[model samples]
Target chain A: MKKLLIALLVSTFSFSAMADGHAEWWKKAGAPYAGTVIQGVAENTPPGQFAGEVLAKDFEKLTGIKVQLENTSWDQMYDKAIKDMEANSGIYDFVYIEQDIVYSYLDRDFLVNITQSLKDQPELVAPMVNMDDFTTFIDYFKDGSGDVFGMPMEAFVKVYLYRKDLFGAADAKSGFQKKYGYPLAPATSFAQWRDNAEFFTGYCAEKGMECWGTTVQGHTGHPASTYEFLESIGPSFGLYNWGVTDDFHSCVEGGGSLNGARAKAALTFWTSMLEFAPPESLQSTWSEVASTFAAGRAAQGWVYGENAAWIASNEEKSVVVGNVGVMQPPTAPGVMTQAAAGEGYIGYFDGGAYGIPHSSKNKEATLLWLQYIAQSEVQADWAVAGARITHYSTYDDPKVAAMDQIADGYFTLMQNTGYLYAGAPMYPFHAAGRAAIDPFTYAALAGEMSPSDALDGACEALDKVMKDLGYQN
Target chain B: MNSSKTAWLLLSPTIVILIIVGLLPFLYVLYVGFFNWMPLGKNKEMEFINFGYNYRELVFDKFFIDSVWRSIRFAIVTLALELTLGFLLALSLLSSFPLKAFFRSVHTLPLVIAPIVVGAIFKLFLVQGLGPIPFLAKELFGFKLNYMSSEAQAFWTIVVMDVWHWTPFVTLTLLAGLSALPQDPYESAKIDGANNFQIFIYITIPMLVPVLIVVIFIRMMDSLKIVDEVWMLTAGGPGYSTRFTGIHIWKEVFEKRTYGYGSAMSVLYLYITIVICWILYSVMVSRGKANEDE
Candidate 1:
């Protein structure tokens, strides 16, 4: 009996050790690391952008590993990161990611999913690994499947910024309701959103305030980044019912098809909404738009409440700093409010992720670095600096909670606004659609092509791209 | 015979560069185009059904045809406008002015600005409500010009923006050609008692024709691939009104992650550009030949 017990104990110990198929990358890359620099990709890094600065500082200090952080704008970075990995350029060690294209990368092993670490590592939890931190990450991070992608980085939910001075003035409020024949409040659906925009534009114009009713990105800008624009209204147009077919293959699944009427209607509404935008808005980017609204020219607009962090930080840059009103994307009639802000709406996955090129001799170092940043503590540090940190716990931390700015408004937006960025295996024609849509969008803004024509052209162009990409029909 | 090896050696570096940077990537594009290639597809060894499906879509896809049409129209219209304005400016510059150098340099200002920066600058001036230009339209003209809002306006803004950025390209080329003109013909015409109009028609214009044709050809090639200004300025919106072929293919390779298909589209677009270029070249050569015969 004694001999049997000894033998069993020995076998169990041996089996457990074997389960660790790879080295403890942290031990090899961080404090205990005895390797090369870890590579990381930082998309959405503007000059002096908060996330990039802190990441360069924190990742270095905490893990004691050098993170080769490549800072670039979101769209260009997305293109390069995908192209780099596709061409196998192992330039990144860690990456800034939105949920948008995460799935496709996960589905393809284009990235290393860290679910195993999540299940095994505890320090990665509490502040770092709070799965429920952001609503979309929780709902959309679908299981080990979500975990399999690089750890969630930042999440931004759509929030409304309105001219408090213009709308809140007692006379303007009552007068607006009387003129529009509706309560003067945040819009609920497509119709009200348009009415509100028109009212503001007309009022602002008459008042000679250089103000306009609403602002949305028709040009590819920040709103387009992380696919905030796609989920912003595309789903409200009935995308929830539209999805890829079962077996994760071709054909429509749940959401409406791209070629269908629902999408076309949404595209039309999108076009019509542009009528109120400022003239140069056709060329405006997200930062410029944010700056425009902050400068007190725009009366209403869809902005990520996290934007206030940028605004408040640069008071001299924004005239309306002390008076920016925050709200959520208006709901459209016949469209479920829930659909307008799905909890699982995620960012573009291609927004960022870390990968080892077949050329790298530093895979172990990269792995260790990934494990370190994936920790809750680092994520919390990120949130404090005003980035859309992926972890809920840090965002909801007592210190963060104490600060009413993000905890109350920005935090809530991240939590309850429902939309998460991740979806699909990366729409094959999304970028193509964006490119084709620019001129068509310009045309729509110009009232040259009706919204339907624009959508049809865009959709057709996208379909052609898809076909070019290898889609059968 | 003795110099054969030396000549081959002399050309080797360029040949190497052409293979590595130019011809190779293009050939690779054709090779990749045949496969249903995703940026993420190769490792998966995901077999794509291939039979010129991409080309088929390019020909038959309504979106593609529309984009091609829009892109073509945009290029043609923009070129005509830019050329007309550019030639006029060149003509004006040749006549002599107090600040000719300064004006010529200022015209190149838009060219020096990065396209993204130009996009930003124009965004301020062209967006609907706040722009000085729109304000002028509303106040001075009593017309609400939502140039950035309407599709027609938005599409034209791109044309205008391109004109701003590249009219100099045409102007500068013409100016250089004009400056290099032989003064003898115009002097002879003037001595023959020719009026300004007659002198311009017989002497000045004919001399500038070859250069104008060259300028047009160069602009055609450049316009076909004009991505940055259009991309940064409109991103191809208020709803896809001003999108171009370059924008289309770029989206395919980068945004869609459909590397194989994007490459195929690019290859086809490239082929079109090459064919168009070839035709232009042949026509120009034939025209030159006819001129020589005359």
Candidate 2:
């Protein structure tokens, strides 16, 4: 009887605590729109843990709509989004999707179509959200036909995160030019970038200093980071600049095969430089990469812009936060490839976009949620507080502008330089292709197979896939 | 009539479960295997292709053939290792020892943990650079051992992890078989002054053959269809060094979105598993019949 009482007391207290956590969003309306919204985000940050408080208090006070945010890790959020959408689980009212999986949702029509949804909820979209600012963003998704699919929320981006102290140690300016006939500044092309990283990291490693020059994400399964790294280096080679001539009617899709000399050469240049990365990079998974970079192990980590927020929060790991450099990714040593005239990589595919599922019964409410988030005010606030990349006409808020990291005009640099690769959307089934590449490609590099043989083997396997799907002409 | 009614009622749930969970899905996979399919129905161009194309490609594709070979190799390697380790463990465990019950329960720990869990733990321990196993290798042995990064090492590491997880299964089964052995032959051998090794080889060996054959058969059948561990640990990676048929088929199902193609690959995989298992079963059964006649 005594034991039962103790157990009962514990259960009651825990249950009430959970209820308070969940129901805190159900506050009395002091504003026009006074309902609670269930928002889901990845567990990487604290917003989700303190969801009932942070989002609810600010959101309700500002918009009169109470937001109930549930946080799970970024990886869990990606998996859950798929399951919830496929099964029409609706467990989450508004899920926070990792930017990488946005394409999966876009391809499957599992997310809310914010472009259309914004029309219905003017109160949500009113003076705060600027439609005019999203012209570039809209035209990015608009193919020949002017249909828009997604509204950008947050972006995980690559900045040439280098060490200033290293720069400080060396004869910073004139010494670099004398050593390598180039100006000592942020690398504008892929070739110079590679050479610099190799020079520093490789040279350091040889000296038995335990420190290498450069690092980035290259986990066996973390393809997203790998793709990002490849793209950063790709542009300097003019790789992403070329598309299979947009005249699809005249040409076969993916006409520019990965097996092409240019692609292989680009990959070779990329792979050969692995000597500069940490030995443990092969096992450094996504979180490990972030923490490693935060731990400041590598001299330069291919880092995301949002890492600024993370660096700010975690004091123990980051030694030089204000001194940390932020800019567009470096070019490969010899990649002079420019985007065919207008075929620029304006939007790299790494931002969250809303999509409406066919299974959704409450499309209106869902649309309202989408429009509300896409508003300029929200986008600006997301940048300042959420520390997220805004898709709304670039936020002009002084709060975001004051960020010393972005003060070097990195956003502007990327805005001007970045390209939207006309690559196939990263759908779920791309997993097979991803799975196939690692073992065979690495083997090729390791002298098991020639590059041509690797391509042939991989292509033949893919051909079988095509044939299995009856995709032969 | 009442007895018959009771039997039918008692057996109905199993029958229903078999249909719902097993037979129907198995048959459906076979049906889906006959055509081209997409998950979201967007690729109208790829909609109606026949199964003939799939068969032709599978027959021709070297990667598919290689993947099949890998899966078969994996199963054979794991089975041999499991039986050897398990048999030895069974011998030791058959006798009473300190903490016998606790140790026996510990032997089944891997069995209780999910295959995915085993994969995760091993991945953490075996992953190149970050894993502790490599640290131990470098510090203690002074070897540049990459259990996962290198192709051959990746395959061997997976095999070793599997052996660790599954050998206990064989041991527990073999222990049970050893425990069930009759004492008459041992008693006669003891009276005749037959030594331990000689008596064991002549008496315990032939008697436990049937149970061992059955155990081998069961383990072989399950090992061939293993997807979760291979997928979780490596996803057949370090450049397809670990790419098994299980990884191939699952990729088709989840990543490729070609449900029909995935179904077809699964059907082909299933066919191979069944044929191999059937051959083993036939040998075991015929051996049993021969023993019975003897």
What clash count does candidate 2 reach?
34
Give the per-residue lDDT of model 2 (tens digit) for A1-473. 99999998998899678545433432222234445454454445522333344434555554456555555555466666666777787766666654444445555667665555555554434333455666253443332345545554555345666665655555544556777887655555556666666666755555565556566455544444335433544444444422222221101234644455655565566555556776666655545655665665566656555555555344566655545566656444333243435434422334444445555554545544455555554444455443455553444555566543433444544454444323334333344444444554555444356656665555455444443333433
Q: Could you tell me every candidate's TM-score relative to the true structure? A: 0.78, 0.82
Residue ranges of candidate 2 with Cα displaced over 4 Å:
A1-112, A117-127, A138-148, A170-210, A241-257, A285-287, A316-320, A332-349, A384-387, A391-395, A406-473, B39-42, B45-53, B99-102, B192-194, B288-294
- Taken over the whole model, the C-alpha lDDT of each candidate is 0.61, 0.59
Candidate 2 lDDT score at position A46: 26
